[model samples]
Target: MDAIQKSMLEKIADLHEVPEGAYNIRSNGALAGRNTTANIDIVTKQDKPGIDIIIKPGTKNESVHIPVILSESGLNDCVYNDFYIGEGADVVIVAGCGIHNCGTDTSEHDGIHTFFIGKNAKVKYIEKHYGEGDGTGEKILNPTTIVHIDEGGYMEMETTQIKGVDSTIRDTQADLKDGASLVIKEKIMTHGNQTAETNFVVNLDGVDSSANVISRSVAKDSSKQVFNSKICGNNKCYGHTECDAILMDNGHVNAVPSLEANDLDASLIHEAAIGKIAGEQLIKLMTLGLTEHEAEEQIINGFMK
Candidate 1:
């Protein structure tokens, strides 16, 4: 890998070198490397342009990384990845994409990921999207994620896209069975006329099922952002969603959050807030020997963190 590509790996996957467990690295529309452990298997799908990740029943404390990188300009790539988590297994899945475009044509990547979690299983999924280059070409990403949780299952998702990406559209949805639960935390930052749109929907479809979705974003320098989320409680369940954002320097942000409750025992709620950074926050940080720009940076960093 080139230094630029390796640098991208560090930012997107937290990998300084080849990881210890199961992993698949894709670069420039092809597979760069792959490995599988005893409890997990990774296989390329014959009918599609992606892979399937399988975690065996009762597997615990293991992880898999599938990170894709693009360096060529005028390239548009798409992939489909499916995950099957076995019953009673507890594991982590790390997946992200990085694009480096240095030409006048657009470089884009679209990934669709689906997860099927078995009964009593617990899974943590982390995904980050990043782009870097000094070219006029746009860096674009569109990611779609779908999740299904069985009875007694739990799933947690942490997704972030905080730098360099010029345009992105992220869509995520989940369905929970009886006694299942889901939690999603999303953070995004856009600058320099960039644009971002995010949509999340979750369904609490069984007794005692629950879901929580939260999004926080910062937009600067005429960038535009949209955060839209909906939670539906169809049975005796609970659902909540929230959206918070900060805008600066002609930036624009719109938040639309909604909820629906169909059953008598179902409870659903939503909240949204969009505003600029507080002057007091900037002042307090600036009093500690920091410039105005530095203070604003610190505040924005803290808010997204």
Candidate 2:
């Protein structure tokens, strides 16, 4: 572990203790400059990494890229060199960031993150956005991820947030080739006077390509959230976009999910719903002796089900 990576690890809680073959790259610098690579089993974290993870076939020439970034712009202005994936490789990638408010007013904190994925590679990417401690509500976190999948490749992307002092916006784009597949699931929970916006776009460029998008969010207190998702298909492809949101007292939610197909041989579907906890179901559970909060929690958990 280098000094910069060690320092970056200090900012994160519950660092996973790595085994012998697991690789860890730590960084406290801007996401553009902290790029690293891995082949077999690897683990890494930093502020942000500008590049993509490329997995190669066979044990000798496995390719990978890791970068950590922290930006003051707060907008989605990020860059990465091209990432390459070998003909056939299997891998798991987790990328995310932890931002410190440091008393900065909200106006200075708007930032966005972007990613690009390669072909014929299998990647499971996990993204986590969180805060260090109590801070002012002026910081904004905007992240955008774009992925391109090749033939016979698979990608799974998921996100989790622990609330923010300010508003947040997240975007995702996945482009898949023939015989490729992408599954995206996003989970978010918010508190305080914060607002969150998320957009998901997937494009199927090859025959037999498939995509699935699922979203779940909870709004509490005086908060707001919006989710927009789109699935595009061509050349006999298959795609689906589904979104559901839950709102609490004084909370607001808006969800728009759409699917567009330009080819007659393509198939697409879109579904979205916005509502609060099911009162009737909660009451029925409470009648069985569960407390109100407990019933609500059970309902929320069941929503994910």
Candidate 3:
């Protein structure tokens, strides 16, 4: 791996070397490396911005990692990744992007990912976005994800952006079939005049289908954030959406959660809360031998986790 790729992997995956049976891609439309097994096929799309990954049928207990890195300044990279999972294939996918820009120019990455999961398949997907540099430049990201789950399929997704991103906008949508389930968890933290906005929509289109959407965020030091989530139920299905945020030091947060049920047997609900950190919790921690700053940091960390 190159110096830039090594640094990015360390920050995002905390890995020294690329793991066995994993795939790697760089932001400059280069295939950094890959180690595939018999159960998975990795193919580069010559006419597209990203690759296509396919999992064989009945393949179980498999894991794949696709990490993207950008080292140059003033660069904008857009990637479109597509995943096709076969029937009864159980897998975990780790995907993330890290940027290092050390010049006075803005760096941005916009990724569009689509997943097609077959019947009875289960997938756990995790994605993270991070930025680092000591320059007067902006690190921006805009991600769009679309998922389709077949009958009896299950998908769980976790996405996080802890720090260093100057701006971000996230959009996610999902469609679930009969006996399918989807769960999405999102976490974000922003500071220093940063801005973030997230929108999610889940459609339960078949009988017994279900979906849950949860979002947690922290904004501090003049930062601003907004979250909007909607769940639509079309059959005898269930859906729930929630958004919670903590704001500090001139931070501003807006949360809007909506639910729509088109069928008489459908059930849908939503909730949202935005507020500052509790004073009593901070005081209790500070009395336990921690300074005010330390207590606040600890609380924020625990809350985001």
Candidate 4:
């Protein structure tokens, strides 16, 4: 691996070597890599910006990793990845994008991922976005995700943007069938003059289907964040959405959570809260011999995790 690739892998996956039985994709024009596994088929489309991953039926305990690295600045990369999960398959995907820019120009990555999960399948998807540079350049990411779950299928998605990203706009939508469920957890922290906005829409279209969307964020040092989530239920289903944020030092946050029920048997709920750090919580940590800064750091870490 080159210096840029190694740095990105370490920061995103924290691995010295790729896993033994996992498929890997590096977005900087490197060839896609995959292990010798019969449970999944990995294919690279000749005319597209992303790969196609198909999990075999009855497969279990499979994992896939897709990470992007950008070594230069003033570059924009857009990718469209698709996943097809077969019936009765259980799989996990770890995907993220990291940029290492040292120039005075901006670098951006726009990724659009779609998933089609078959009946009785389960999928867990996790993605993290990170940017690191010392120059006066901006690192931006715009991600759009769409998920479709068949009857009796389940999907859980987690996305995080810890720091160093200058701006981001994320959009996600999911539709659930009968006896299906969808859960999404989003975590973000921004400092300096960074800004982020996220929107989520989920539809429960069948009986006994459920959807839950949650977001936790921290903004500091003149940063700004906005979160909007809406859930709609069309049948005998359940839905909930929540957004919680912490603001510090001139930071701003706006949260709008909404719910819609078209059927009498549908149930939906939403909650949102944005505030500063609690003084009592900090004082309690300080009494245990931790400095104020350390206490605050600990609390932030715990909260983000």
Candidate 5:
């Protein structure tokens, strides 16, 4: 696949072609294409690089597309992907990664993903990360996600990083049981001297377990952003966490949300908001003529959609 790896797979997994049932595509550090159907199964992890996605028992409308692409120069790629959703399954998973560094040294990728969602399973996971060229080296990404949900399980995760990456670190962890439920949504954008970090830890052990975490970020030039969240409720649980950030030139943002409740009908909540970009929303989009950098890029693309 040329044309800069199919335009980095249509900006991370909105593939223009070659997508149906189960799929795996990786470039610059191995396997370029693969497919498996009939209730989905794609294996190849003889104790090494990546791939093992299996969804069988009572599988419904199925889907899987693992996407990773890096364009050679000074490559450092690492991966270990795993997902098993069985009992009463309903599935959809589209993983995404893209990088195309032109020269001068650093282009790194590290991904470790694991999810096992079983009894009464329902899973929807979508991820997107992107980077581009005009190189002078660095475009580094580090991602790690782990989730386990069992009795009456349900999981939903959506993550997006829509900008040329210079450095990123994102890690997520979750565990839930009886009447389990977990949901996470994160969107991030960073500009020039870019650096971003997000970390989340959620544990709602049993008895009507529930969790929700959300983060939205936009930091422009001279960027630096960090958000950390933690939610823990042992039994009879419910948890919530949210962080929102937006900043402009010479931007920097730091947010922390934390919560823990041991029992006694546990319920937890946390929220944070950082400011910038609302001088009457750039004078109401410059009286509908749109100039302040196109009304702050249309309010940061409608607040990252």
Candidate 6:
């Protein structure tokens, strides 16, 4: 293992022993190996009222599970495994991966994350994948994640991916119960010749349940990207989905958004768009005597601003 990777594993070596409760894991400067794999398993019981996790890389798989035991509601309100957000409690989870190198050898990676949020509970989730300056070659990864929330619960999830990756398929699922709310935002930026695909699904299953999904992607050079977002609503629920992409140079991006409503009392909306840097806007800034790099930087700052 490289120094950075070793250091990261060492820091969390005792992760299996940490007493759970609002845990945060960060590996901003590490990388997962080209041929490495990881599986994390977490067990969260009511008596513990904490978080659990597993993170290590190499072709090895990792897995984690948080049992959803409701303190009030019965079994009918949540998903399987009693993974509902119980009344008044809160749970937050973040799962991410980093690669140091993906050489010419076609390395493959697959990551799966699953969660069950209890009724009346709140969960804030942030997931990110990053790798920069590694030149191995043809790298592919597929990440699948699931989340379930109960009545009056809240779920917020944000995901990001940056550098050294050729392609990624990310799938996310969430179910909201009565009066529950779910908000998901995904932002991705790709450089060099790469391709990425992202997919998200939100289900509003109860009365007054609300869901929102926002997706954004930035493609540069010869890179390509695709984003698919879907929202479904049940009885008296509300759902909204929006997808937007920015293209630069010879890069290309495709976005598909859809909304489904089973009940007339339910509301749903969906929109998508793909476009390049606004030349008129860039020219206006260039007229100010800014260099090419400065002009490009200004546009990027504006996009993110």
State which candidate has the highest lDDT: 1
What's model 3's lDDT at 31? 67
Name the lDDT of candidate 2.
Answer: 0.63
Global lDDT of each candidate? 0.93, 0.63, 0.88, 0.87, 0.91, 0.60
After superposition, candidate 4 runs with Cα above 4 Å error: 29-32
Cα RMSDs of all predictions?
0.8, 5.2, 1.2, 1.4, 14.8, 11.1
Poorest 10 consecutive residues by lDDT, candidate 1? 253-262
lDDT for model 4, on a 0 to 1 scale? 0.87
Over the stretch 91-133, how does candidate 1's per-residue lDDT look in tens digits? 9999999999889899999999999999999999999999999
Instruction: Output the better candidate (1/3) by TM-score.
Output: 1
**Against the hidden true structure, what lDDT does model 6 obtain?**
0.60
Per-residue accuracy of model 6 over 190-209 as CA lDDT, tens digit each: 87888888888888888999
- Checking candidate 1 for backbone clashes, the offending pairs are none
Q: What TM-score does structure 4 among the candidates reach?
A: 0.96
User: Which candidate should be chosen as best, given TM-score against the real structure?
Assistant: 1
Q: Cα deviation of 53 in candidate 2 (Å)?
A: 4.4
Q: What's each prediction's TM-score?
A: 0.98, 0.77, 0.97, 0.96, 0.40, 0.72
Worst 10 residues of 4 by lDDT: 27-36
Pairs of residues at least 3 apart in sequence or in different chains that clash in candidate 4: none
Better of 3 and 4 by TM-score: 3
Better of 3 and 5 by TM-score: 3
Which digits, one per residue and each the tens of the lDDT, describe model 3 over residues 226-248? 89888899999999888889988
Where is model 3 more than 4 Å wrong at Cα? Answer: 2-4
List runs of model 1 lying over 4 Å from the truth.
none
lDDT of 4 by residue, 1-305 (tens): 67777877767765568765666656554554565378887777678877788888888997888777776788888888899999999998888888877899998999899999999999999898899978788999899999999999999999999689999999998999999999999999999999999999898998999998989999999999989888999999999888889988899998988888899999998888899899999999999999999998998999899
